[model samples]
Target chain A: MQENRSIPVMDVLIAVLLIAAGVASAMSARHLGKSVLEPIGPGAFPLAGSFLLIALSLLVIWRAVRVGTTKSNVDEFKPRPGMAVLALALTCAYFLVMQLEWLSFRWATVGYVTLLTAALFDWQPRKLPAAIVSGLIMGLGLTYAFTQVLYVDLPS
Target chain B: MEFLLPAIANVFTPMPFLMMLLGTTIGIVVGAIPGLSGGMVIALTLPLTFFMESTHALILMVSMYVGSTSGGLISATLMRMPGTPAALMTILDGFPMAKRGQPGRALGFGIMASFAGGMVSWLFLALLSPPLAEIAVRFGPYEIFSMTLVALMLISAVSAGSMIKGLLSGFLGILVSMVGVDPSSGALRLTFGVPDLETGFRLLPVILGMLVMSQVIGDIVNINQPIERVQTSFRSMFMSMNDLRRQWTNILRSSLIGTWIGILPGIGGTTAAIASYTTARNFSKTPEKFGTGTEDGIVAAETANNAAVNGALVPLITLGIPGSVIDVLLLGALIIHNLTPGPLLFQDSPEVAYGIIAGALVANVFMFIFMILGTPIIARLMYVSRAYLIPPIIVFCVIGAFAQGNRLFDVWIMLAFGVLGFLMMKAKIPTGPFVIGYILAPIAETQLRSGLMVYDSSFLPLLTRPVSAAFLVIAVLTLFWPFLMKRRKAPTAPAHLEDE
Candidate 1:
């Protein structure tokens, strides 16, 4: 069976969108400085990268035409939604917890890591408790190790 | 003689010796795990080294690097599942040999070949790095720019079928690179209403998205496919001395191939191992034995890949340039300790520099010993289901991101990159070079800008300067060389396809 042609087209479209976004952002940046600040300014490396991106995007578009329908079903594939959500939730909790000084980054880490780990290992429900316990042990261990032993500063 | 004396003092110190073993043990375990690589092991350890004594710290790090590369062969031989990417080629014959009841002989060939390749590469590094460092000292912005151009061209080499799609992915990454605040102008590029995207994509999340999350997505979708476990024993892991004797030539040839490939930056162990295997098969008297359980196949692949580890270090230690993303992370780790990696590293701190070289030697030795003893331990871990493993890994990723910087921004970036990375992988885009490009961009910019600053607002000196011009030439040649090779191989590929 043959694969769909839209995959490469979509890839090209995504590249174009990225290029447009990059160029538009650069234009907005020009307004902030009026003229680019000299010698490592607010706009220098990014503007250069933007122009390069535009050129590269155009190249991507051109190549998409030549690569038309060989046999790869790019759209037939789906991004792993389940694991990604689990990972995303963990991140959101880590960040949201960072804002509360009373919660303390150290203390919040224990709660978040423990809960996320328990949810992830649904294999052995009995092992879930062990996972939670290990998470707590590791979190506190790291807090002491990085903050006290290594003298690295952590969020209070 | 001058180098020999200081190397002795720094290398044999009791703490350094102990650390070398400790690092090697950790590195072997990490590398032997299916999901981890020597590069990642080095990266995480890099930050911690800042607080350590220079010699002791270096001994540990270099040892781990060597050990991890060697350790990958364990899973590759036993399960046909490679613990690391470079070991991918090893499974072709290593697993077949195991299935044929010759796992012990297959292992013996793999180890001896690894030792020889690593030692040979170490010799090359010891003799060659100083002279190469001298040459690197003459390089300027143009040279660095050209070097990056060559490194970027490596993406073409990695792309199996089509170079254009690979390049497009790379360029797409470069475009993504544009979205952050401009280094030269501080202009924000792509953050729309969401303030979070403004700092541009932090690499870890993107990498995680591509590597960890994308993989999970596929696994979850395909959860209905049942995977069977193949159980083997520790008793079968021993080799006869005669088996080692017979495979010596393959081991030596592959070791040489591995060491030379390792010397070149951008080209990695996977390429070297594959190249050596191809050469070994081509040169063999009995080619039919290769896939059906040949020791020569295992020897060729394992040796080259292990040696490639040492070879990648050449540029990092001598040029203050990294060969890969993990190397860049290593560079970051060094900076955190106020240590700059490059040619000057040898002159400024001979002990730390030589300790790395000596430690690599020790690491390989220890890797050999531990791999023999530790194979059973690692093989057992494979029995632990991914379902049991996934949750802890997810948590670690979170802690790793937030711990590096207390910013939740980093955690978000890590998740985003993880998704992007996964999709990119599925689409057949090579993520290795993109990560290389993202890390090298700042270096390329700073050097070019500084060089321009010296020339009174003219970009002409970049061409007119002899040293710079040479690098530009090399860069241009690098970009075009693949096209030239493909043109030459055109007729051969068709005939080859027919034979296949």
Candidate 2:
């Protein structure tokens, strides 16, 4: 079979996103003209950076196309993203719960840690208790450390 | 020298001593763990330092820097898995030596070499930084501007992966840093009408998200990967005088190489170790013995890496330029304490500057003592379950972000940067340049504008000014040196041929 010689999808996506970001930044910065005291103003730096970003992003796309796809590069990305995504979601939910003032920092953290740890533990029946205990220790320990020792005002 | 006694006295006081002790212990434990790094631990600990005195906080962080660099040898020797990137070269000789029923010997050599390196570089840091700061204090706006440019370019050029990607990451960082109100003119530029962004993203949230949370996500993904634990006794954890006598030259050479590399902006201990290891192999009579458990190899790698930790501190204290990724966090710590880093720092807060120098020496001593006494316990701690560790680390990240501004908005920003960092990692674009660029952009911009204003907007003095011109030339050369070398090495290409 012929080798698959296509540009990496990730690179292409990244390049596109960078191009968009550069364009957006440039557009936003264009209106802020130069300041009187200095010839170059606040917008000048960002504008230059945006242009360079666009140029470098174009180069990235060119390089990716020229190099084509390699087996090792494809193999290198064998990440189990499911667990990572779940962790991120759980973290977001934990933050939301705290933001909503649904529970105190201590309790909310305990629940968050327990659930996340249990999930990460792959929900093994034997490991669930260990996870819960770890959660309690970490949540309570962190709350005390921050509030009492460090004097950080944790949300109630 | 006058500042040294006061600094020593300040550090030896009970509270500062305890904090240093605690920081070193924590740093060692974290460094010995495979997935955790010194940078992540320092970033997470930064907010906690907010409550402490600036001197104590700096002492704690500096001590952590010393300890973490020394701590990587344990796992590298025992398990053939490097605890930190700096220990990478150690694995070649260290693991083989351990496998041959000499684990303690490997670790002993490593620990001694680490101590030697730290002691050597601490001397350089103490002797060199004051004079370097004297010269740097004379720098004009144009000179400073060009110097910052050189630092950024050097980092991007030397960073792993594609140069284009590194530059892009750096530029993106600079752009991100431009989101708030312009410091000089007080004009809003890139807030996008969000009230939260009017003040801009603070350093803590961005750093916590990128360094700590991203790693946590990665840990979660790879939590199931099996680790092979190595068993060893603590009986032979001390090297003999004969061994030290034999390896003295090798240790000295590696430490010197490491210190040189560390003093250069953006490069860190890993590079220092690699360079030293290569130099050792080249100089060795028994070059063939390198990979299969050579004492010289272990000595070279460990000594160079530890030396680099102190070497990196040189530029940070003297020029306000971070010598490595971890030094960037140190710079952030300085800024958090409202102490401006650079030559002015030495003038205004001689205590802080001298404290760091004295603290490094003290920390090295502490690191040596701790690693010697606590290796067995640390080896056990290194294998702690990720299921428990990851969640707590994430919670710390949340609290760190929230504690920064006492707002959930900062936490959200932290999460956003976490995802951005994770994606950047997947793309193999180094985060080092990004953070450096973010931190240095304002300085670069302000200096350039000030220079321009002084020169009547001509932009000619940037080239006409000898120091600034020289720095700009170095920046350009650094950026293109890789491509030049590539062209020279290409068998089929003409010497004048350009890369795409």
Candidate 3:
């Protein structure tokens, strides 16, 4: 577990950032204390959390130097483009739909259900009707199950 | 021994028994699907229990808890796709066997081992939980603070890259939890002047936001990706007696390791499974044969992960500290049922308390049947195209987030957190630490500040308080051990993860 693998220099940079954040946290803790709680007061756990992080980061770098290239999957980081954006957009829309109450619980369910299933199954525009129909059906079914049989009312 | 009979009878009641069977069968199917998770099942069902009597609802829930958790191995072993993150390690060695056309053996051993680990842990929970709760009754703010510190120390075990990032995420989580008006004083630390800020953030929304949404975002990034496929035969889903005889010791050892890890504060089942898998592989006679479809690897990982499910429940039941996010959801559900678990639960509601234990045992019995019977059926889900899987889940994620407390703003938070989660994940920050930190921050603050008050704002009292000092020492020791051990045996600390 302990090898002197040379750490990527960025680790040390991250450590420095951690130390700075810890100091800032400590200072903020003092400032907020007059109204909230004092330095190491409301901020005690977080301050400690930040400090421990700094130390742990330092240790990882130190160990990385000794135990170089410890794992093959270290660079397994990957990113997707439109999918993330689409998911985010859908989530944001879901939020707005809830806020306006323009869509009742049942409608909201159908909208989300249909959109999600199409998104999930990678459906095309031509298939939109089918997705919407199924979503509406499942939505109504769940709404009925919860509101009528289960007797749990959905929020407006 | 004599008291155990009554416990069995309590679980075997006609309705309770039927629910257990039904829950486990449903749990396995859901769990074996690649995109769905144990938490999702609990989330969807959480509302269903609100209308029911508590014990019956709990019976259904616990059966699902046991069954779904165990069923992760089916996909992990046969399809090379982990049903959940915990099963990821199972696939490392498991898929090789499936590729070699011995998937039945892998799946079989995983199922049987899951049953055994889950059953043994249930027994442990049944026997040990009451006594543990009794001990917790003696805990004061000093003791609780110490416990939180120990939990903080566990972050070292959970964090992946640099301990710094792990600890930072933990600290960040604590800071986030401090958003609402101060519980002790009416001052807001982080929240701006929104009325919703008064209650701070709801746990379910925040969790669903970060865990589920982040995942959806990650999926979206690769919506058009084509993944390789694995070929499988439903053949040989049974382990031979000799294979069984060879693995008894490995099974027991891994179950013990998983439970012990579960008993720890923040490590959860991911570490438990990895640890169990690593240990089983390291000690096996055919170590070289590992990662090439060895039966024991699947067994060890499957058993440990499932056992860890019950193991994680220990802290939730005894100390009121959730051992994982699922436990956090369970805690929320308990509140809905008017069943707040803690040291006093055993005294106030022995029937409810014992009922959960009895129910878990029942859950696992159902887990065994459902796992064995449903494996062939569930193995077919791997055939579902990813194109057909992603969109619907995103919709559910949106609805799930909205359903938590029904604030649309909360859904925004979920979307934001989802992207943030995906980013953090991309940046290699461990998500588990953020969650554990979030849950513990409030507790740690209340305990530490209260302890300070009890000692009249004096730092001297903190050092002198026997419990606090002991806990601090343990935390420090746990943190520095990796460093110390690294220094002494830098060449061979074994591996940090995946037990085998």
Which of the numbered candidates is closest to the native, going by highest lDDT? 2
TM-score (C-alpha, index-matched) for candidate 1 = 0.85
Which regions of candidate 3 deviate over 4 angstroms?
Answer: A1-80, A119-130, A150-155, B1-23, B43-61, B224-230, B331-341, B386-404, B458-465, B481-500
Better of 2 and 3 by DockQ: 2
Candidate 1: where is the Cα deviation over 4 Å?
A1-17, A28-45, A58-80, A100-107, A154-156, B53-58, B158-162, B168-228, B235-241, B481-500
Steric overlap count per candidate: 24, 0, 45
| Candidate 3 residue lDDT tens string, B1-500 | 34445756877888777777777776787677776777667755765666777777777777777777877787777666677777877887777877777777777888888888888787778778888988887777777877776765666666765566666666666666777766665556554457876677766566665666666566666555444446766677677889889889988998998887777665677778877876776787887676777778788888898888888788777767666666766766776688755666677766666777788887887777766776777777655655445555554554555555666666667666666666666656666677767766676677767766666666675567686688778778867755664576445324433243
lDDT of 2 by residue, B378-478 (tens): 98887888887888888888888888788889999999998888777777777778888888888889888888888888789999989889989987886
Candidate 3 yields a Cα-based lDDT of 0.69
Angstrom error at residue B122, model 1: 0.9
Superposed model 2: Cα runs more than 4 Å off: A1-6, A73-79, B481-500
lDDT (tens digit, per residue) of candidate 2 on A1-156: 235577677777777898999999899999897799977788899899999999999998898888866544333234568989888888888888888988889998999999998998888999999988988998899888878887997754
Error of 3 at A137 (Å): 3.1
Best by DockQ: 2
Q: Rate the local accuracy (lDDT) of all candidates.
A: 0.66, 0.85, 0.69
State how far residue B162 of model 3 sits from its true place (Å).
2.8
Cα shift from native, residue A71, model 3 (Å): 13
Q: For model 2, which pairs clash? A: none
